[model samples]
Target: MEQRTHRSEVMLSESFMYDGVIIALIISVANNLYDLGVLDLANEFILILIIWYGIIEHFIRNSNVINFDIRYRLLFYTTLLGGAALNTIVYKTYGISYIPIIIAPMIITLLVDYEFGASAGLILSLSTAFHHHDFFMFLHLFPQVFISTYLLKNTKNRIQVAKAGLISGIVSLVMILLQEPVRHFYFSMRDYIVIFLNPIFSSIAVVGILPYIEITTRIYSNIGLAEIATINHPLLKTLSLHAPGTYQHSLRVAELAEHAAESIGANSVLVRACALYHDIGKIRNPEFFVENLKSPEENPHNTLPPDVSKNIIMKHVTDGIEIARKNRLPIQIELAIPQ
Candidate 1:
């Protein structure tokens, strides 16, 4: 009972920490927007807080994807709010360049998973529109931002990300031109150049920061998960050498899980990756496990009582968790170690 109470207290404390971080981000963005003259001091700043929190609450209530993983929740708000903050600073420093606005979706989508990425883009678009009170800018940018999520949804490498950028550039350029009708608008070379270059440059910038973003977040985008699922990973190599039977078991489990996940509209790549590393703990007691034993007659558990054997069998869950943590596997993969 006392242990359970302690665990509850710990969970509450962590929840407080999470809320505190999100609140700080909100205030920082709000304060910066006011400082930049985008929001009036007294009313708009407070209103922005209310609206922003409302959006977050709505998102939390509706989103299973972000809510399922604490890391995703944190990363979602951080990227969304952080992008808003950067937009303010850039807009303040440079008169009204839409560079930050153009690139915000790519960064957010690349950092968080697609579902959060799509949601964040829409949130950012609304926040940016409200900040400047420019509904047309919102109209102009929102579609591209939303479109970017779809483009990057299945991306598997830098080249694919770059290709997503190319598509975004084309789509954004069309939107820009369509909104400002060519028949009525005067086209300066500089104006034409800005329209063409904004998304192109944004894509290049996204590609440039992709590696650093992956390292910092450690939350694999679908593509990143695929990349990490390779057989050459050091932990898999250790499993192959130290516990061959367990290694083969992992491979078979991965195949079965991947197939099942695909049939059910789940994340097959993620499921397969988790399955591959699920039994890493057996590396420590390879000879004791039935599957890894050299001789079927040399039964280790048969010599032990039921309780002791049960304890030994259960210890692998804890052991696998430890190994997963030490190796810095993503939380999703580590979470599957027990089952």
Candidate 2:
């Protein structure tokens, strides 16, 4: 199974590279006016870097956790490189530019992870300082972008992202005061609003849409945690009311299986899942199970010989599997049922 998963990843890489390049190319060329003399050169370099790192790097060396849909990777590759490309175009065509400014970090944050985004933002912010020779403003934005993006790392929901943004805005206020000349080129009083709002809106945007993204991908970002919790889900509420003994047994087995997983370095998720529904078979004959008997009800095999009674008990395992399958439980849960 591991080998099968590996092959799937490898195949995906091979098929996706061409698409990544095309995405980079399209985004890079868009609104990028080549007629600009000095800015044109800068744009080319930035575009190349985005492609080399975002798309090519992933293609040549697969990341442990980070990845792109072959085609989508293309879009991201160009978007970043293209931001530089577009920046150059704007500067050359009309001299209105935020290429190396606002758009750069957004590109980095969307395509790469947070740390990478911060580094990219810091680099660009520093480059601006070099171009205009203002070390103070350069220093201010560099650390601010790093701190803001870093705080935003691993953000799964909008509320948390917004919190980070809020914190960032607060920090920006401090940075502004510390910078001395309150009348500097920045927004002054408005700087406070921008600093706080940038993160708030950005975090909100990501948080608002993350669920739909997860659903479309069918990717279990935290499948292990969620899967284990589901075994005891309220659907089992019905099971508890109807087969209380079975519920208790399943719970105990799940606990034991968790211990076994620690002992063997096995897939703990699968073990926990197996333990949860191992005795779904008992649901078929609740009366036969001791816990479900309202009143010391007579055993069906009370008059049978020991060997005959044992066979009846054994039949429940097979019976449980049918129930699990009938309900369309996950394969891991279904397979974990008693043999």
Candidate 3:
């Protein structure tokens, strides 16, 4: 109970810190816009405060949609802010058509989920449109954002990401042409190419940088999950060699959990990955575990008191967490070790 209380306090402190960081980022961005002469300090600043309030309220109301974990929240908000900053810089330097509007949505979709991706895309589009005072920017960006997110659902490979980007680029090109029909026809060929290829190049850039993001954030995308879920992973290979029975059990559990997750419309790949690593702690004391014991007489628990055996069994949870951290496993997989 005391531990739980301490944890709660820590979480509350983290929440306060997260809130401070978010507000600071928002103010910084607003001040930057003000300096750029894009925002009128009188009315637009008030409007931004209102928008920030709405965003906080939305997050509070849908806490499950946006994870409470500090890392996840920081990543989500930072990605949005970064996207907005990039958009602003690119818009000033290369014009609105050259803004990589799909970057935030695509990266969030691949790293988190469709819901988060879509939400980020909406917020980004709304904010960008307001900044530029152009409703057409929202119309132009929102559709491609949605398209890129939808196309990249359950993405398993780099090729799929590139493909989604290509499709989004095509959609963006169509929206651009439709937005100003007569003006677009008068556009130079280079202008058309820039507008169409912006999303594609942005996506390719995401593909190149995704591994680094995953490494820095410790949040694995489906692509990363897929790679770690394979049997050839170092930890799995070690588990197979040291605790064959537990390794086999993990395989069976992974299969069942994956099927169950799919039936419930959950992330089966994540489920499978978690299930595979759930029993990894047994590798430390393979002989103590029933699955790894060669015979009934080989049960080490037989020589220990009930309380001692129970403690030993429960120790696996902490041990697993230590191993997971040492291996730099995804937090989801580490969390599943206890359950």
Per-residue lDDT over 1-339 for candidate 1, one digit per residue giving the tens place of the 0 to 100 score: 999989976785566456645654574465355454533433344554565455544555466656567877677666666667776676666533354564656766665556556656666666566566776666766777777777886566677767766676677667767867744456566766665566677778877776566666666666667877879998899999999999999999999999999899887988988989889899888877888888888878878899998888888889999987787777777777765
- Cα deviation of 164, candidate 2, in Å: 2.0
Q: Rank the candidates by TM-score, best first.
A: 3, 1, 2
The 0-to-1 C-alpha lDDT of every candidate, in the order given, reads: 0.69, 0.54, 0.80
Show where candidate 1 strays beyond 4 Å. Answer: 1-56, 95-98, 102-104, 110-115, 181-187
Candidate 3 lDDT at 327 equals 91
lDDT of 2 by residue, 1-339 (tens): 999999987787665655445543444344333532356435543654564556345433554324533423343343345444544564455431122233445434533455446645644554434343467656555655666567655433345456655665566556656776853554555546555555456445445444443343322222322443464565476678778878877788778887898688765655666777777777777877677676664766667798977877888888877876666555445545665
> How much is 53 displaced in model 3, in angstroms?
4.9
TM-scores, each model vs. reference:
0.81, 0.46, 0.87
Better of 2 and 3 by TM-score: 3
Model 2 scores a C-alpha lDDT of 0.54
Per-candidate clashes, comma-separated: 0, 5, 0
Identify the superior model by TM-score, candidate 1 or candidate 3.
3
Clashing pairs in 3: none
- Using lDDT, give the best candidate's number: 3
